[model samples]
Target: GAGVSQSPSNKVTEKGKDVELRCDPISGHTALYWYRQRLGQGLEFLIYFQGNSAPDKSGLPSDRFSAERTGESVSTLTIQRTQQEDSAVYLCASSFRGREQYFGPGTRLTVT
Candidate 1:
């Protein structure tokens, strides 16, 4: 079975800039999630999308972060005005339902 994948395994950006992190989930997966993990900390949920359902974004840190999923295929997480506080590893996960999520390699974002 194919696993979830993410692009630009590492990214370096300047403060106040923006970055787009990409994720390609396993084919046929209907649920996708975005999470952020700070240095030495636990993962923090950012958003979730299910087939044809409204996205759950209750965990998004602030207005600068957003995510989109196109029909259960590729998903992207966009962060506007990147800041030092926003620096973290952005992880993506996909699953058939809401459990047993398969995780990607994660995109490490570094803001200077």
Candidate 2:
């Protein structure tokens, strides 16, 4: 079984640009979550998707951040008009029913 994976591992972008991060979750998992950890800060839930229901976007930082999951599988996070404050480690996790999620290596975004 393939575990969750995130691309780039690190990204450096200029402020006000747009960036896209990718995540590939394990097979058969029905729940996917996105979180952000800014340096030494704790993990902040950004969004979650379960099966076919509506995605939980309550934790998204602002209108610039958005995510989408395709049929309980792969997911992508897009940050539009990226700002300096958006620089952080974006993590992706997946599990069955949001229980015991497995994490990816994460994409470290650095805004300059």
Candidate 3:
């Protein structure tokens, strides 16, 4: 499989709207992670997935953000009631041992 891929490379939506971002990690990789990078900040961890389970989600900034994956396949991150502050580049990474990771281009979300 390719390194990593993300869909809807860019997105713009009104406040309170909802959006879903998708990520496809390399084949055979069991570790997936979601992060967010604002205009001028480093990536902030959002969620981590091992296989189909997420044991830690303490990095989630709010309850409005959620993520799920299917047995090491594709993963989706949904943002509900999107806010201007939610506008950022959503980054996805995958790894075999959960150490060295490959990253996707990221989905750019903009809320007006």
TM-score of each: 0.97, 0.96, 0.95
Estimate, for each residue in 1-112, the C-alpha lDDT of model 1 and write its tens digit. Answer: 7799999899999999989999999999999999999999999999999999999999999999988889879999999999999999999999998779999999999999
In every candidate, how many clashes are there?
0, 0, 0
Clashing pairs in 2: none
Best by lDDT: 1
Question: Tens digit of lDDT per residue, candidate 3, span 19-106?
Answer: 9999999999999999999999999999899875644788999999988898888999999999999999999999997779899999
Clashing pairs for predicted structure model 3, backbone only: none
Model 2 whole-model lDDT (C-alpha atoms):
0.94
In what order do the candidates fall by TM-score, top score first? 1, 2, 3
lDDT of each: 0.94, 0.94, 0.92
- As a whole number from 0 to 100, the lDDT of residue 32 in candidate 2 is 93
Candidate 2: which stretches are off by over 4 Å? none
Question: In angstroms, how far off is 62's CA in candidate 2?
Answer: 0.6
lDDT of model 3 at position 86: 98
**Candidate 3 accuracy as lDDT:** 0.92
